[model samples]
Target: MSRYPDVYKSWQSNPEAFWAEAAKAVDWFKPADRVFDASQGAYGRWFAGATCNAAHNCLDRHVAAGRGQQPAIIYDSPVTGTKRALTYAELLDEVEIFAAGLASLGVSKGDRVVIYMPMVPEVAIAMLATARLGAIHSVVFGGFAANELAVRLNDAKPKVIVSASCGVEPKAIIKYKPLLDSAIAMAAHKPEHCIILQRPMERAALIDGRDLDWSALVDDMRAQGAKAACVPVAATDPLYILYTSGSTGQPKGVVRDTGGYMVALMWTMKNLYGVEPGEVFWSASDVGWVVGHSYIIYGPLLHGNTTIIYEGKPVGTPDAGAFWRVLSEYKVASFFTAPTALRAIKKEDPTGSLISNYDLSHLRTLFLAGERADPDTVTWAEHALGIPVIDHWWQTETGWAITGNPIGLGALPVKPGSSTVPMPGYDIHILSDEGHPVPQRTLGNIVVKLPLPPGCLPALWNADERFGPSYTDEFPGFYKTADAGFRNEDGYLFIMGRTDDIINVAGHRLSTGAMEEVLASHKDVAECAVIGAADALKGELPMGFVVLKAGVTREHADIEREIVALVRERIGPVAAFKTVRVVARLPKTRSGKVLRGTMKKIADGIEYQVPPTIDDPAILAEIETVLSNRPVVG
Candidate 1:
């Protein structure tokens, strides 16, 4: 039986009333008069008449409920061998002091502040403090290059910038202040003030007049008896601007509103994660990304749950047992991570010995996102952990998960490669290139009906002109997702890959995900990525990059031949899978998304610029060397 069987009907009957009731879940100072306002075309407004503060709902309200001594954030950094937990009272004190410090620096409401800090407790503190003052925050990934940081600074034109001295890695230390200085020099618009969080591991040169010490400012504010108070603002006010890579090489800032984001994420905590107040919830992601902002900081905190802020890699900090240790130590009830992290652990410890060594009895459910979860990886995790491996799908534009099993509401049957049915507020459809519905099981564009849900991005920051053409212009009254997939008979949505990832061979479109799925099912293959290489006759031929399991010593040629035959037997000769190259590792971004486009460029002998988001830039050079040594096939 469907737990939320009547959800669609209730939403359809009166969306405004439904969302109005949902909005009451948060601590709003003034109730909303208008539920939704769409008079400004596709740029709609939610809770337009309401006034509230996000930080108040996330911190102060819980403290007022007599939960002041309860744990709010648990900081675990294996790289630095440091662990600390802050209760709600302690967090409020820190946030208030920081908020006062920002006020002393002349940071007022509506001012933009760029946060360039590592994944520590301070990142969350800075974000909440910025929100407390009604200022907008833009967090640049700590791993981003100076040029990338400059681009965001110039675009957002922040009045203040917050950063750490350095970031700690397992092998080396990343000096961040140098990068911040270089970025400030390169940017056209520079901030008036810069605050540096001094890390004990390494130090960088600080500017005299423009820079401020984090501890000095906070202590001064505390001594002066400065109080942090939430400044109420209209619900339609912009909360944060998160930049996402654009096809045109410019990062588009996705602007999320405060009212809608708060309501949506709070609902997600109970409905999607199946977590309640005081439960330990951990989302293994950085604070720089949307997943981190929504799940790690806002969602769990808003629901009064204790959120874990981890500062280390999945396998390297100590071993493959690092994640298990944290889960057991924290007694986490719900856990979320990316599939790429799981694949890395599987490659290192194939027998699941590391997972078996820990006591994970407290773990209730496991969720996967950020990338498509392969069936092999999902099945392995479900069998080894003995929990439901739920794979949900969403984008940076949407602040929360859009499709999943909805474990809190009676988890639906798991389909190996599918993201399952859409949530209540979403009306999803698979459309043809001509903007018409496609038949079931036929690949096409994924789109959502117009008037997107509350949590969806209202518009791009200062790019209102580009918003419509980028999202809705492709299909009238619909938001184009740019992903290619189809719906199954059971109403499950299967995302093959991005629309541009479709390989056209001999006038036929073949999904790389389909071929990769077959390759992953093989016993010898640990992980794989498929890309279309240039071919003179076929236009484009499928090329496979396979990462073999540990301790596999079979000849490369024999394994390649077996993979080719498997594709031919399963997907037929139309696939034209010409070459299979075994490689040590694949290039991935800091968020664990495979750089298939870069791989394709290398395979075709085409010169391409290395993306700044890549985790290890040297991996591309290794891939090029492997491609050059491989024998060509026609």
Candidate 2:
């Protein structure tokens, strides 16, 4: 009954033919000379020799197809108390005018434009407008520190910068213009011009002769009926340069091509998400991240589905009920978010009471990504919503999903911790340290056979030499995912954690994720993290940290004892999971990824730099105090 086996086989049989058939979904300006070119990029390039416009496909084609009246973007900001919808026609008009504004500033094909803004509709407009002129746009997360932004600026060397006055948070207004100015002042490369959007909450002082007002510029262009036509670019032309932080403290700008990206997104919108045109799809994420780029902006638009731009947290934009209200009001059919968001909501409500307050009949599926989705969180979400809580595996490098449950073809049986079968074009294999294929159900390194799928990053911007040493050189003829997981007999993939999370204990390799799963299953524990702490005898030993639920009044000592017993019973003593500690909160990135590596450094007593992406630096000090105050548990 499922089309997955055949579809996957079809791709495996002939990848080019499979992708060629999928390319029919998009409207290309010029047909590709080859389905794929082996001699082009690192490994290869998809849809080589083709000409296309990402913005045109995302905006103009929909407007011309009589779907202009449909809502293209619904901006929902619980923090600012603002909600507005822009139709396809209106959105297209806005983007074209903005494109013309950028053009007037001398931005042209191949020029890089750095966008530093919050979760506003203008961020999407900036990206699409840049793409409209065949320019590359790199969006830095608004919450990043000034030095981090400066690093990206130096690496990207954007010709122009687009930013806003401020970003509204739950309890405070962050003045972004100051941060943007500081970053520019710190960077070696200076942008020719800056377009600042002055919000009512905070008005920024614009630098004379170098800065332009966003409203005034765009309004003037609109008054003059200036609409920049979409420029045709080669399929291999870079659409955007998204910089992801590397372990070396240098940012790696990941390049995504236009035509191949569009094709991959279009295919996944229907097959992976199971959403149709005119329906609502909300990806509750920030525009600064890849999910926002692919889902909140491009994927839904290319599929003609209404997408929601949410500017609030999972818990405190008002309360835990915030997401449910948006889903009920917008009638969202397919919802996507990170598992950490669900964990926060579950920790707050604990009873699933907020969910029953709204009408959720229209909601069908919920997809979780961005990190490892623990079985506890998945089960909690499933029981709360009475719908499928699908945990899909992907990375920032790969724009879309590498493995997922293809609900469009037919819903596969739900496996609690496994991210169901690989989508077409991803030949996933589990390889040991020696590059030998491992046995089924044995944890090892996960890698994809090269000539990665269309939506994946081709290479790091201006770092072609580093790409090989960083990713492909470790294992020849494969793209290193850097994740350690296993494939079940049924072919489902279980992502234990990052490859580095696998610790050698007394000559046995154990997964910290597996131990964390046991810790999280305890009823009193809301969320947990497991890091391999350095041990003299065992090489490394697992240390557990957990945050308790909201209303739990139980003693921390009792709860910690129970968690240790659970892990010991489930994973056995070989895990060396003796150390356990209770913390008020886990330090996480703004995108909700727990900072486990930092915690490991603290436990090992090694000097560690505070990660720029951390949501709160103070939490790291709290973790340090907790580790220093108490001795390791038996």
lDDT of all predictions: 0.90, 0.92
Candidate 2, residue 472: lDDT: 95
Best by TM-score: 2
Clashes of each: 0, 0
Q: Tens digit of lDDT per residue, candidate 1, span 1-634?
A: 7575576578778888888888889888998878898884355788888999999999999999998999999999999999999999999999999999998889889999999999999999999999999999999988579999999999999999999999988999999998999999999998999999998888667799999989889989999999779999778888899999542388899998999999989878887788889999999999889999999999999999999999998898899889999999999999999999999888888878888788999999889998888899999899889998999999999888778877777778999899888876788988988998999999999998978888889989998888888899989988888888989998899988888899899899899989999999888888999999988888999999999988999999899999999999999999988689889999998999999998998988888988888899999998998888756645
The stretch of ten residues in a row with the least summed lDDT in candidate 2 is 625-634
TM-score for each of the candidates: 0.98, 0.99
- Pull out the clashing pairs in model 2: none
Measured over all alpha carbons after superposition, the RMSD of each candidate to the real structure, in angstroms, is: 1.2, 1.1
Most accurate candidate by lDDT: 2
Q: Which stretches of candidate 2 lie over 4 Å from their true place?
A: 630-634
